[model samples]
Target: MALDDSMDRDPIHGSDDNSPDRQGRSTFVAGERTGEIGVTLSGLRPPSRSIVEISPANIARRRLANWGAIQGERVNVTRRETFEYGFQAPRHLLIAHERGEREDGETLIEGLPRSTLREFNCKLSFVPAGHKFFGWQTPRVLTRVTYFYIDLQDRLFDLESGGARPTIGPRLFFFDQAVWDTALKLKAEVGNSDPGSRQYAEALGVVLVHELIRLERATTATARLIRGGLPVWQQKRVIEFIEEHLTEDISLAALAELAGLSLYHFARAFTQSFGVPPHHYHMARRIGRARNLLQAPTLSVTQIGVQVGFRETSSFTRAFRRFTGLTPTEYRRHRGG
Candidate 1:
């Protein structure tokens, strides 16, 4: 059968053969030639130009395809800190051949320095299917690409209704494992015989976001060092400082000054009082806030770090692991929906 014929019977991209509408095709279009049907083709040349739409669904698809095409899993912001947005592209179907691959893999997609600690905003442009970003080939079957402009002009983009900021800002982000899993599930749902499967996925996404918000709160307190004393007054003051400058690094030194205590005196006193070091306390606060922002499936990890005062993803990871006993991915998996 010819490529176009096969496509007519079943689009190479969108519709799955096993779907309820098996006799028809979906939105996917691989390479359909005139009158071709399920014809096998390799080394196919992509069109000279490919345009991707910047819609939410399409953006989600594009990001997922880029990170999970070979891996089969979604991408997650793992260790966003000072240098770049650290992405955790989990091992999956396409690139399961390697170990520690997820730990070592990182792609600095885009950014510019805003100052010593912050970077400028970014406008994510959708690349055509099969195009390359870094070294990965974008999924070839996508119908549209979503465009997200990360406004880094202000690193602190809050979770409007949440207690803390969770995601990194100034860039588009994808979780290798999460994106892949979500997309695959979405695809599977679209192919499911049940009429409500797609609806379920949509519901699941909403639940996931809510769960993320709750988890962010639980984890944030770990980064802080709270103790006895002027409980109400101190809490108010600390909370005010933390909330006001979630993006700027919060240190024991700074906190002590705010509390009107010497570094040594504050360290010993605060530890005795809060049961943790000042630095640990501050970091806990930041991470907790970060966890909340991360709940937004849309924001990137590096953006989260920038929002939470992490100078780099590596530093964030180191600190996060020390406090939480798990990598960000592990935390997200256990905590995020």
Candidate 2:
């Protein structure tokens, strides 16, 4: 199939260790990540997603690639702190936030208004080829996400004409029971050593893509601007300011001024656009940045906390624990630093 042709040239071989291959199922290697799709997947450029896609600093990953049709990665954030993923890809990508709740954060896709909806467990997000998607969060718990990469050159074909249409629009943290179930089945197959598990996993991948096609056809109605949210230009300006000031104490009045709205209206509209109060969102971004810093040991915990705007170590630790269920020290330990 052209799917294999679209993926990285490396082939997935059976694991030599006496664990999975003997079960008569095609193997899922637990070794180096340079398997079928890892190379090109990590090769995409600037504002590099290699850290997020290949080996996130504080994440422990278990990957499964079956027949080079689809690749699935089960990611466990070792700590409950901040984390993010982003970048464009050469192929279709789907993400399942298996278990996560973000106190503050947002999902930015190329064509859609950014999504700030929190509490996104069991939610699915799709990024079409060449579209940029990035998101971050100060997790409310240790997060688990299942990522799927499908190397599909022409993702969809209209049956009547049998010609491929565009795959699908970028989806940000949406729900579709059929698609979710199929994705979950693929993730479960990661641990399955049963006979035919390989074939079963690959079959599930096909079903999952088809389910997405059905969803796309069902929703071609059109996407309208969110009535109560900020206009795109105003939103872009406000978000740009907020992002640049993540480590500073930002005033709501200042943000409102930047949005050209009165304080009360700006607060409401900002919440409508971002799904959280501006201060909460700011704090979440700070905590999230702090987490990435924790992944490296050069900085002391206290210095790291101060850098994210907490003046006192205790305050930072308390806030970090409140959001992530772990202190900076404990999180660092989990990172093996």
Candidate 3:
């Protein structure tokens, strides 16, 4: 995909990272100086995607591949990918939040106060070595410092947010190998030699999105049954069953039978109790599990999608994006693990 021809002249394009001069009293990276492109980011909404595609050939040459602007708002820096290209402008700092015990992978980081986001001067670069899709390195002299996982198994690092004198977020980097795997899967699946398989993979990304949007609006009570407490127990049992065999073609009929009821009765009961119907609930669980897999430092969006019942990488990505506002790569970046 050719980029906009005008991005070349944009302020984000700078040859040297050490060209900015301090005017009044502003913080700058010691030893290495970077230019600041002044811009406001108010009302800029973070991406609501859940997948990323990082292929070697395309990823090696860095460029402004995935970013958008809002009217009269601060420029937002989103999940930047690694390639050979140099600095990008309108950079925004990514603040990583700490992880919780139950948080297995990238899925644990959710419901952030986007309203409380701090800003920072930011840019991304690729490391020469490594099989992983993403990795991170702090700035050092001589070599271009690439923060966050940019190699293959990329990792995130919390940086100072807000203008030249930005404050850094608290300590905590969410590291999950699964995110790397997912990216790799997408590269392979979408880049597969078989065109039919590739199209199927792409189609899945679309389906995934449709299912996730439905899940986002779903409520806990809406997920319960009219039978009240008994429905609750059944729902739990169904969830457990689905989790155990998610890889299988588990269907509403299968689930209904598991609960010793007809498909119609089971579907209605399940929907009444859980807010979503059986298939939708199952999809929610699969997507939820997929989110956990995405947190792995090694898995890519595609790989995680496959692991969570998505046969095609694109489908997984589409679905993941719909459920979370950010793509898989974006989600991992925010988590900083």
Candidate 4:
């Protein structure tokens, strides 16, 4: 399940004002806003339009990962707003609402409702590949959401059966903690300076896809869990690899390839062997490294945090506290003093 290197070479086709897509009647202007790379969707064709377009004013941040792109936005409507929009790309779309709610609003796709009444945070809506949607919403204070656009054509989850690939049905106002958490992680990488963020984003996309597939199966029957752990040699190799790239954003797909296992099987086997998830193991190792670095009085706490893969001092502090029940400052004051 190693990621295809070709994804890195694929040209990202985004709309521009000067050169608009012939099929679509809209133009986009790409630029960086407040350190976030984004595209402003504008120039709707029809004369009568009140569509809720995906614009920079609505989008807070955006990140283009390998298999898909993630966008974080806040939709604010002072007055009642109704709109109809459609996406042309043949890809799956996931929208997670973090905040806000509207009891009167209704969003429809292909003549179906997308928004739910009395549901606010963590609500999700999914649009399958190649589907066109039309939505309408009532006036609300503001709604914060994260959008995950997945290009299913990339064949990131190829199965050996050679049968039809699993497809996610359009769902509205559902709750999936796993998908929500992964989307948040992807959103966090929007303007990350870490060199491994891309790998991390790609890994999250793979996990999200697998989770969606599992969700699809849950409707009919329980998902069968894969048995057993990795071989001793494979376990050792993956452990060594993690240690070597402790500072980098290690992808689960890459690790699965090293073990010659599917992502699902590899994750199960990894947890079985190590008594923790791969991400937790990596974080533990990072904190261990941070502990070792704390002893060196010359390195500041922030420097130690960055060295151990935490981009923010607050995040490093929180992780350090969670792992050792002490912040970096407190740990250094007691242990490294």
Candidate 5:
């Protein structure tokens, strides 16, 4: 059959006949194509230029791509203290925070309001085409993330479906076990040279898309995080104040007034919004920022503590030990070690 005719059938399931989608197609077993349905054409040119939207500072990227369109990157934010991560691509991006913990950071996705909730280990973030995803973090440990780039097109963009697109919404810091597992499997084949690995990754990419189609904002816990939290403008203002005054003491009444809520209500709402009480969150931010400062060899432990709002070095050491199970000196040395 002609290539265009074959393209009309389900790419994964195949046409009525058991023949390959194209005439004389390579038996490399490639992944799903960004476009041009049916079995993917070998040496097929990418639909568009692949764009990676990570900052170049202190970032190391390992990229993987097959003869088709699915591209993957394992981004390692080196132990240089802190790093920023964001996405701005012509294609969709599936982000898996494989293993990373942040002491301090701001997460902003186009769909969700800005967020100050840190701890993103195993979190999943999906940024649809044309949306912006931005975040910068002061790390508590080495940060590693796998970014799976889904070629944005109309599989209508599934591998098994007709040319009609499925509804897939944007999500930030959400959880979806199916998408996460499929994305990780695809990422594992990034550098593999085995003959079947490419095809397997491609197949996994198709599976990942079907998983993404299952993302429903109302059905997920992500909506609850906001539903139980503060308003968007209030969350932004409150987080900004906390970030600006991390090295100083800020009162709850002050924050409450800022949020235009009474003291009692503000405390409850802030905790509900950020999953932590106001004071506890403030202190954590101070210590988190201090951890970042410790990475600078030029700064003395006492200076770092003072910079993060400690009146004395001893008090700073005790608080740091309380929060992180290590004194300032020990934490710094351990990080170096």
Candidate 6:
């Protein structure tokens, strides 16, 4: 298959005026060929391009959104259609099947086969850079899928092996709740016009890439910590301080001081004992407090966000979604608030 020369150009910020259906949807001609389906993955390359055209029968609607070089799309498959196509790129590909009725299809990437995907079953596929992958599927029912494009050269993973890049093999139908959750958040950010949406999308992209690295390195032996963990009194003091100052700008330096250790050593020892970074633990505590505040009908979302240390509602929403996979309002609603 021939590559689209236009794809080499900067991504076009599509508008509803340019859409064939004029349904207020943005559209762009991602490539010249028709075989390539779905939206172009973002962040696979700097100044990424968007895949605007998709088979009308195969895709009912698609929304393309970008965060820096990372791009994503939410696709609604309308009909059952078989397609055979290949993708060649310098970036990695992540695909998550969000929704589907009949779980009776097959996909093959570089001759590796996987059975049909089921909803929320932790099934995802990863395609590495410099690879040509072929996929064929004929869904028996309508489906919703999301795709994330990532550039390996971004140095986001920090793999740094004497300038030798680590390579990830093709993964098919794997179970990873974290990756799935991050993809869902990315999908939720698609087509959002808020000013902070891009930053939220970028943060989610970083998280997704980190999860990818963790998944790839799962089999490797972890480095041993210099010491077991923070002393018992230090751990208790830190936890209490975090709870009391949940709304303050608690810095890593301050936490390290409280723990009476260097920044690097404190971080390592904290993770060794708590199974999460200090910042992560702090965020979890904040989110936990926010959840309780959200249950109170008297407090508005903004007020709750402020009470939980977030200055902006958007940032709070993004962080909350990252932890619980739901916005504050969504969580409250589900909890019968």
* Highest lDDT scorer: 2
**Candidate 3 structure quality by residue, lDDT tens digits, 245-324:** 86666655677777766454566676667776555555567778877776787887777767876777766666667667
The Cα RMSD in angstroms, rounded to one decimal, for candidate 2 relative to the true structure is 20.6
- Alpha-carbon TM-score of each model against the true structure: 0.30, 0.49, 0.32, 0.44, 0.48, 0.45
For residues 1-337, could you state the per-residue lDDT of candidate 1 as single tens digits?
A: 1111011221122322112222232111252211212321111232232221111222332233221112122322222211111111111011111111221112222242111111111112112122222211122222122221112122223336545434332222312343334334443333355666545755444433333344335434433333333245654686588678766645555766776654545455566666765555556777788778767767677777677767677766766676678766667778772
Q: Residue by residue across 1-337, what tens digits does model 2's lDDT show? A: 0101111211111122112223222211232113222322222233354223433554655555554667787887776665556667677788998897866544566787656566778889888877766655567787888888876653332323555544688887788899998998898887678899888887788788889988886665212223367888988998889788766767767887897765546666777888976666666777899999998899999999888888789878887887799999999999897
Residue 117, model 6: lDDT of 36
Q: What tens-digit string does per-residue lDDT give for candidate 5 at 41-123?
A: 22122223454444444465456565366788877766746454555666787889887676655556677665555567898
lDDT of 3 at 120: 16
Better of 1 and 4 by lDDT: 4
Candidate 2 global TM-score: 0.49
Task: For residues 218-295, write the lDDT of model 4, one tens digit per residue.
Answer: 743322433456678998999899899887777777887898765656777787778876777777888899999999
Q: RMSD for all candidates, in order, please.
A: 25.2, 20.6, 25.1, 19.0, 22.1, 20.3
Better of 1 and 5 by TM-score: 5
RMSD of 1: 25.2
Candidate 5 global Cα RMSD: 22.1
How does candidate 3 score on lDDT?
0.37
Q: What C-alpha lDDT do the candidate models reach, one value each?
A: 0.37, 0.67, 0.37, 0.60, 0.67, 0.65
Clashing pairs for predicted structure model 6, backbone only? 42-70, 42-71, 43-69, 43-70
Q: How should the candidates be ordered by lDDT, best one leading?
A: 2, 5, 6, 4, 1, 3
Candidate 6 segments exceeding 4 Å error: 1-58, 83-86, 101-105, 111-122, 155-165, 221-337
Greater lDDT among 1 and 5 belongs to 5
lDDT of 6 at 1: 12
lDDT of 6 by residue, 121-240 (tens): 336878776554443344666667777877757655454657766667787666688998898888889998988998888888888887887877762322233256777888999889
